[model samples]
Structure formats: structure tokens, C-alpha cells
Target: MTFTDVLRYTAFSSDPEGGNPAGVVLDATALDAAAMLRIAADLGYSETAFLTPRPDGGDGPGGRGFGVRYFSPKAEVPFCGHATVAAAIAVAERTGPGDLVFVTSVGEVPVTVARTADGRLRATLTSVPPKVEDIDPADLAEALAALDWAAADLDPALPPRIAFAGARHLVLGAGTRARLADLAYDFGRLEALMLRLDLTTLQLVHRVGATDFDVRDPFPVGGVVEDPATGAAAAAFGAYARELGLVDADADSVLTLRQGVDMGRPGVLTVELRAGDPRIRVSGEGTAIPTT
Candidate 1:
């Protein structure tokens, strides 16, 4: 199996200057788990997606799409939103834009790719059934301790919770934009706690307005200090807001997430929630980064 078959692309934001970049292995049928891990490690991206043909008669559309697995340098994640978008566009480039289903460790995710009015391909992924719950006070305290932050630093409006869309994340809201901008954290300590909790990332956010927010993620468990832009977290956050009645559920709502500014790589994520639809829709544009 040659590694050349794998493709690389950035997702969520279009400029390559913005958005998260993920590695895509559209056909990983011949590669074992170890090989995939090795490739992910070599790529050194936050997450790399590996695709393998699903067995016939599974709960997907003819398996035209494959069973997808996501791996960071250090561990396997249940699912990754940015990588899924990257992989969807990669597949669309090869198989044409349409509906594709990915059987993931958490659940089945359906993604659709369509050409935008500006002639760019955009992918929208509907998250698996989502759930949100309150975070334990002790756990929240531990998280705050690891970040060297106090309860006062938290945003009272957004609160904190553990949310799941295809993966688990602890959603934390900073009290002010300055608090969000300051991101010094104990990486090793946070990683240990996150491993115990099976958390993929800590979704730290600061709301700029009712519909606009700035976000950041500390993904130490994934062997990264931070993710440039996180799609899965965005989906989970949408669910969190709906579950908390932070946003009205009767109207079609769109939320804008700005991330990665501190790291110098900025990204934008558009999250849509339709009334009466339980699923969250995440849409973004991706551009290929030219390799040296």
C-alpha cells in the first residue's frame, strides 16, 4: 500500500490562511490500524481520516461511502468534523458531489457536497444524534485548575457542559474576549484529565454577540496544543445551545464561529439548526494547501 494515494486539504475556512487542515486517506482498505496511525503521526496534523470500504448490508447508502476512522498523532478519535469535511470534498473531487455516508465509531454521518455559486465546492455534514449534559462541578474545577483559571473567568451566560455530536467535548465559555485570547494551559495535566474523561477536545469559546462567537480548542489528547478550527465541536455546541434554550429552537438559526486567531491561523465555521430537526448542519469551504 502506497501512501501517495492519500490526499491533504484544509476545511471550514477557504483561504488556507483560515480553517483547519486535515489529511485525507480516501482509500485505506489495504492499510491496517497501525499503518494508519503511523501515517497520521508522520503527517503530524491534528487529525487524519482513514477510509475503508464498508461491508455490504450495513446501515448506509450502498456503502458508496466508506467506514471512516480518525486518528490524531497519539490516539484515535471517535469522529472529527474538520477531517470529515476534508474527506468529503476529497471524495467529491474523485466521485462527484452528492450524498455520502460515513460509518464512524460513534455513528453514521451523512455529508453532502455541492458546488457553490462562486464555483467552489462546499461540504455540509449532518451530525449524528447529539446530546448535551451538565458538567460536574468538580470536573469543571479540575479543568479550570489545569488552565489556571477561576470560576470568575467563565462566562455566566453560556455556562459549561459536556456535549456530544460524534465525539465528546467539554464546552467552556470564557467571561470576556480577553479571557478567551489568553490560552496558556497545563498541557500534560489537561491531557491526563481528558484521557480519563474520553474527551476529544476542550471547546473554549467567547460569545461576541447572539449569533457570533470566537472559539478555540485544546486537543492535548490528540497530541496537539490547539486545533485551528473544529467542526465536531461546533456541531456539539449547537446541540448544547439548543438543549440549554440559549437559542430559540422554533426559528432557523445560524451561528458563526471564529477560531484559531491566536495561533495566527484563522477559521470560520457556519453552523445551522433547523426547527424541529434534531440534527445539526455544519458547512464550510476548504482549499488545498500546496505541499513544498
Candidate 2:
């Protein structure tokens, strides 16, 4: 396919102008890795998704599945949440909404999409089973130094963690909303630390209420200064919150994450966790980016 075949969709917001924009290549059968990376670099989005049909698929959505891959402007990632949501919405617009599976580098991720009553398409993706681990003291200190944040700036109750749903994220909680708003970091330093830690983004969050949070993601490793709305990070944060008992893990819980407001590209992501289920489900409204 030609370069213009790429479609743009904004995830986590019904308004195209309000969410994280992602490039979606619904059919990438003719493109190779180098070509895909070139397209992503040309688009300059945080991440772009390239999908090829999976014919030897197992169970799910009409035996029609896709092998999906994600590439940032700099490199390929194991998975991307906003791009996943965007691609699902793109396919749903064509094939109609239902169950669809994406065989990713990490594992198979199941996605469900349906049109909302308001004429917007909503997509929910069930992440691979999530896990959380402790961060090394040296690494934690280095990350804080890069962000120009001190130990006192952190919320002691939330603590620091490394959580993984589809991709790895270092979870850090701010003591105040202002802490999250004022985002300035040494890009080279933070990117080096993240590369060493194999982290995708620093999931910096400020809890607004028991179930509301304001999140900002620093993604220097992806060649982006910051990610406005990060669904993968949100999913990992949901798992982290459940493990820390920040939410009722034994019961059904839904949390709202408000992101990108400081950057003037506000987006909302909904994270859902069910009782006895380890997998996190992240849902959001997607809109087509106007081609002008």
C-alpha cells in the first residue's frame, strides 16, 4: 500500500482534537518492518499500529483476526494501548463491532468494540495478565533525579512500583496535582534510565479522589517528549492500584484517569477491573482524525 493509505484516529476521546492521535494501518500485508518504521517516523505520532490479517486464527470474532504490531517513531514496542484501541475502532467501523483478537509480540489481546448511543465508537481491550514488582532503590533515585522530583514530592501512601500489563511502566504517584502538572525532565537522562529499566513510560499520577486520577506519561524512550493519553500505562496503573489495595480488588471497580490536560490535549481513559480477574480492561471513545 502507498503511504497515504495510513489512517489517523484519536483514542480515548470522542473529539478528534482532544485525544492522543494514532496512525492505523488496517492492512499492512505489503509493508515490511523498515517500511512500517518509516511510516511511523513520517507520521510522528507517539505510536502507530500496523495490522495484517491472521488466517490461522483460533476462536474469536468470525474467525477473522489480525496480527498487530506497534512502532514508535524511534523503535518497535511490544504493545501500545491507544493504538490498539484506535485500530479496533477502525476495524469496527468497517466490519462492525464485536470480539477481535490481536496476536501481538507479547501475546494475544482480545478487543471488543461497539457503537455507543451517541454515535461514537467505544473499544475495550483486555490486557495480558498483569504483574507488579518493586523498583530498585538506585533506579528509583535516578528516575526521580531526571524528573527533578525529590522523595518528599512523592505520595508515601501510593509508593513506587513497576507494573506491566502489556508494556512495562514505572508507576509513581505525586503528592499533589500540581506535581503532575509541572512536568519537565532531562530527556537524555530519563531516556537512558528508562532504556536501562526496559520501561516504556513513567506513569506519573496524582490521585484526585478514591477512583479519580490525573496522569502524565514521560516517554523519552519512544522519541516523544510526553504522551497525552496512555492506555497501556493506565492499564498497568489499574493493576498497581488493585495490588496496593487503593481500590476494592475483591469487588468490581472502575476508575477514571484524566490525562493530557496540561498539554492542551485532554483525554479520558476508563479502566475496569473485575473480581477474581487478573487481566485489566481499558476502554475509551475513539474518533477519526479529520484529514485536511
TM agreement with the true structure for every prediction = 0.96, 0.97
Q: Candidate 1: what lDDT?
A: 0.89
Per-residue lDDT of model 2, residues 161-271, tens digit only: 999999999999999988888999999999999999999999999999989999999999999999989999999999999999998979999999999999889999999
Q: Lowest-scoring 10 consecutive residues by lDDT in candidate 2?
A: 55-64
User: To one decimal, what is the Cα RMSD in angstroms of model 2 from the true structure?
Assistant: 1.6
Query: Total clashing residue pairs per candidate?
Result: 0, 0
Q: What tens digits encode model 1's per-residue C-alpha lDDT throughout 1-292?
A: 2533767799987787678889998778888889989999999999999987764544365235678899999978999999999998888877788888888898888898899999888999999989998878888899999999989999998889999999899999999999988999999999999998888999999989998999999999999999999999999999988888878989889999998889988988999999999899999988777776
Which portions of model 2 show Cα errors greater than 4 Å?
A: 1-4, 55-63
Local accuracy by lDDT, each model: 0.89, 0.93
- For candidate 2, the lDDT comes to 0.93
